[model samples]
Each structure stands twice: as C-alpha cells, then as structure tokens.
Target: MKRRRHQKTRGDMMKKTLLAATFAVWIFNVHAQGSMTIYGSIDSGVTHISNVAGTKLTRVDSGNRQPDRIGIRGSEDLGGGVKTVFQLENGYVTDTGAQLNPAKLFNRGAYVGIGNNFGTLTFGRQNNFMFDMVGKYSNGFLLGSFYAFHPGNIDDLTNAGAYDNAVKLVSAPISGVTLGAMYALGEQSGDSARNRAFSLGANYAAGPFKIAAALSDSNNRSLTLGQTTGIRTLLGRTLISGSAQAPVYSALATDKVRSVAVSGSYAMGPALLHALHVQTDISVAAATATMKSSELGVNYRITPANSLNLGVAHTSLNDMSWDQLTLNNVYSLSKRTAVYAQALHQRASGTGTVAAVNSFGYATGQRQSAIRIGVHHLF
Candidate 1:
C-alpha cells in the first residue's frame, strides 16, 4: 500500500508539471502574436514676426511647432514570418483641440499593409519618396517650427498634401538596402489626367554612412486669376510673357512638376554629419522654371540629456539665392519629454526673390530675411 501511494503521488506531480509547461507555452505564443501602440506629439509655442506680408508686425501664440499629432499603429503576426500592419495618424492644434483639417480625420498617414522579411506593401494616404528620402535629411526635421526650414523649400512636394488614394510597395532590406515606389489613382472616373503623381526611391546604408536618392513627378490643372495692379501686374505680365512660371495670374490648365533629391549622412562616435541636395522643375502652359536647394548640418551629443545641432542651407532660383543658418539645443527631461530652443537666420543674395505667400512663403522678386525661436515636445 505504501509503494502504491508513493507511485500515485509521483504521477500527480508529473501531471502538474506538464500542465504548467503547456500553459507557459500557450502564454508565450499569445504574447508573441502581435501588439498595438498609441504614440503622438504635442508641440506649441509663441512666434514673433517682424514682417508678414499684408499684416503688421506682431507676436502670435500658435500650435504645431512640430505640428501636434497622434497616431495608432499595430501589427499582427501571421504564420511563415509574415505580418499584417496598419496605422492611422492625424495632425491637430493641441492648444485649441481642433483638427488641422476638419474635412479629413487621418491627415497625416492612414495605411494598411502586410510586412515580413520580404518588406511591406501599403495602401492609402502615405508619404512620397521625396519626403521620406530627402525631407528626412533636412535640418528642418529637427528645428520644430521656429525654423523657416521646418518643411524644406520644396513646398510643392511636402505641403501639397500627403498622397491620397495611393498604393505603395517596399522591397525587403537586403545587404542593408531597400527600395520603394508609389502611385496615386488620381480618383477621376474617366479622365485620369486631372491631378496625378508618382514617385520612386532607393536607399542604402552601410556601416556609419547612408545615402538615399529619390525622384517624384506631379501633374495638376491650375487656373490663375489676374489682377491688374502694382506687383500683381508685373507678376502677371511676367507669367503671360513666359519669363516666369508664377502660379498666380497664369491659368495652368495643365501643370507638371518634377523633383530630384539626394541625401546622405555619416556618423562618427557622438558627432554626425548630414547633407542634402534637391532640385525642382515646374512646367506650366508656356512656362518652365527650376529651383535648387542644398542643406548641410552637424549634430553633437553633449551628454545623455543634451545635444547641440547646427545646420545651413542655400536655396536658389536660377542663380538668384538665399541662405539660412540654424542653431539649436535640446535637453531631455525624460524619454517622452524634452525641451528645445532653435534660432534661424535667413539672408537673401543676388537678385533672388523671397517671402512669397504661396506655400513656402518664398516670394519671387523680393529680397527678405527673418529669424525665429521656439520649443517642441513629444509623447
């Protein structure tokens, strides 16, 4: 009887151990299945302007130094090293709690795709190759809002809006390199010639050096309203005479724009060097013109909690040009909280025009300069 009882007890112990082991395996599998995360940033600051076209000098408190934004991203594991992924992101004014655009909810990025060791295929509103490749390398990526360079002078590529109704495919990283391309549907039922764009890009990284190149082209129909007065007359005449391809006063019932950019970065210990060169061409009705810009920057890590950044860029329109210099310091209070101050000085040279109010605030035919300082935060 004693032997039989001992045998039963040992058997029960073995069963319990096996049960616990099985439960542990189940838990591990569940944990490895997938995850979803919520992330975003809230940045706002006060800006003092010395001169704003059609407005008096003033100081205004504004939101979106870095552009307040929120995003939801997730991924689900599938068998065979494949996964399903999606992201919905939007921009808003944190101070006012208002959407940047009431018309659209996910104004920043809204895409769904399948990703795996083979790469990712995504659809919906997403960033273009130029923005992903060249824009990311600019000093503006670090300056938040106080810097005039926040969005690079290629306003036509960055500001016209994120690509909508688009489909994109990215190749798996191989030998430390990846390639991507995208196309927009134009959304026209029959005539697909109204407004359409397409882009392609490739990036390679090896050791401490990385390089990226991209090209994008867009076509749109434009109508310009002519005003026969003052500068408007001069600009209108220039547009009509084909001397300049100004967007105003000229009816570009059809317009085409192309951009090319190359960016690279090199890292050495706590110091890094970055640079980019971008060129854009616009063809509208009987007008064709080109704009070129370049940026060079350096970043130094002073400590675990602080860093210093300096950048310079030169923008030119057919020999006429302007240069901008920026200096910034960032101090981190925590992983999700930080404070920064950036100062920018822009000067115009040659016969280049600056401060036009179209998109990048770069106007043609005027020489102008300004400075800005502000802060940014993320969570």
Candidate 2:
C-alpha cells in the first residue's frame, strides 16, 4: 500500500510540472506575436533620346518612372506597447534582370528599429532627411516622371543620395508638423570626419498646403555615380575627351558636398501646384562649384483615374545653365497598375556646357529631348 501511494504522488507531481510548462508556452505566444509582409514594384518603358554622345538612340529602359524594387517588412510586438520592426529592399533593373548594385544584395534599404508613441528610430542604411522631406513632396515623384527632377539630381532631393552606416530619427506628426534627422559615420580608420554625413529636415502640412525643407552636409565623400551607386569612374586619372559625357557624378575623396532643398505644394480642387528649389555646393581641391535649380510644376486631374503633369525648371552652374520642360500623363488601370507617357526637353547654354536631363545620358549638343511610354505595377 505504501509503494502504491508513493507512485501516485510522483505521477501527480509530473502532471503538475507538465501543465505549468504548457501554460508558460501559451503566455509566450500571446505576448510575442508578430506579422510579416512582402511587397514590390516594377516599372518599364520604351524611350528615345535625341542625343547621347551625339548619337540618337531608341531603347527599352528600366526604372524610368520609378526604380524596380522588392521588399520585406515585418514587426514584432514586444509587449508594453513597444514593437520592433525591420525592412529589407532590393533594387533591380527590370529590362536586364540584374541587380541595381552588384556589390549589395539589398541596395535600396536594410534597416531595423524599435517604435513607440514618441516616434521611430532606426539604424543601418537608410534614407536621408532630404529624401524624407523634399523627395516626398517634389513633383518628380508626385507626377511619376523622373526627368522632372533637376539635371543629374545634383542635390539628391529625389533620393539619388543614399547614406550607409547611418542612424535616423523621425518624430510623430504634431499639429501637422513632422521633423527628422540622420547621421552617417565615415567608418574610416583614425579619422571620424573623413567621410561622414548629416542632414536635417522639417515638414508642415495643413489641409491643402504643404511645405518641406532639408539640408545635408558631407565631408570627404567618394566619387559615386549618381551619388548613390558606388560605381567609380576614372575621373581622377583619365583625361576625359571633349565628346565624352561631362562629370555628373558625386565628388571624389578630397571633396565635400553641401545641399539644401525646399519644396511647397498647394491643392486647388482638381489641381495641385508645386514649387521647388535646390542648391548644391561641392568643394574640390579647395575650389567650390555651385549649382542651383528652381522649378514650378502642376498636376491636374482629368478624372479619378487619369491625370496630367507639367513641370518647368532652370538650373545654373555659374555661367553654364540649362532650361527644362516636361509633360507627364498617367492613366490608372487599377489601384496597383498604371500606364504613363512622358516627354522632356532640355536646352543648354554657356561655354563648354552640354544638355543633359536628370536620368538620360548627356547630349553632345546644346539641346536634348526624350519621349517615353511606360507601364508600372505595384504588388
């Protein structure tokens, strides 16, 4: 009888322990639940340029209206109203089916952060404040025409600049006002200021009027294609021929860059009017070159699914200047699909200057024009 009683007690203890273990697992599941989502966008166009190295060409291009990209984003509930989030995005060329940046798997974005009521703070490769403010408000994106941006996207207000090894903070909207800041470390050995970058931005939106402003400063940055792509041209050693495309990329290791951008928009019934200005200064070998651009644009809605956009701008680099005009029309097939057409012309004046649109290669002559039709899909 004693032996049977002892066995019964041991069995009851084991059952209680098992039940406690199961209850703990159930509690963990409730507290740490999370959700994940995948998303992407593709844009392709058939385009013709009047000049590139003095040659007229017609070709199918990728990412004319917007870059092709795929991304994954997720958030995990950490309890206590706090959540941790992450995003990974890859940019690619739709026509060639190749990665936009051969060196990176996730060239567009890769970041992780935590959030709460105060706002969100993220770390790793991320957008600069200029992109958060002016890029979002600029007609280039709002009108779905990359050519509407300034030549070479000199100020990087349209996201041509990407800062790596960075930390960013964005505040929650307060009274229709939002503010953001970002800092990127140089990561150079024994020198903290060699290749560092920082930016600040502010935005205000109330009803039909919106305004945004941003400024960025960099120290001893690299020579980059478009200021974002790390591809390096042989500008340092090779003597560029006269017929070669002029230097439009970011500055070299001995150079410093500073950019300021301001943009505003107002809605008037079916039309939205926009104004934008950008100033960029690059210090190279103790010589500073300044470029300034000013633009006016409007988007008119013909119907709920069709719209037209017009943009005109002038950019000056000392005695050299360019004037640009663009027209963009878009028709929506659905919430996630659209077909669009764009036309652009640019005229250059001043000694040794050639015409070049933002996305197109340089023209050998003083004038350049392009026309494109494209389809866009988002998923």
Tell me each candidate's TM-score. 0.77, 0.85
lDDT of 2 by residue, 148-194 (tens): 77765757775557788988888889999999989999999999888
Query: Residue 324 error for model 1, in Å?
Result: 1.0
**Candidate 2 lDDT for residue 216:** 90
Error of 2 at 150 (Å): 1.8
lDDT by residue (1-379, candidate 1, tens digit) is 9999999999999999999999988767755787777788876554444334434343434442455788989888887999998999988876578888898899888999998898899999988888776666666664334353522234333433378888889898799888999998888879796578888989899999988898887778342312211023221234333233433444434377778888888989988888888887767666765668788898898998888888887776555566777777777788776676655556656542444321224334343333334456676
Q: Pick the candidate with the highest TM-score.
A: 2
TM-score of 1: 0.77
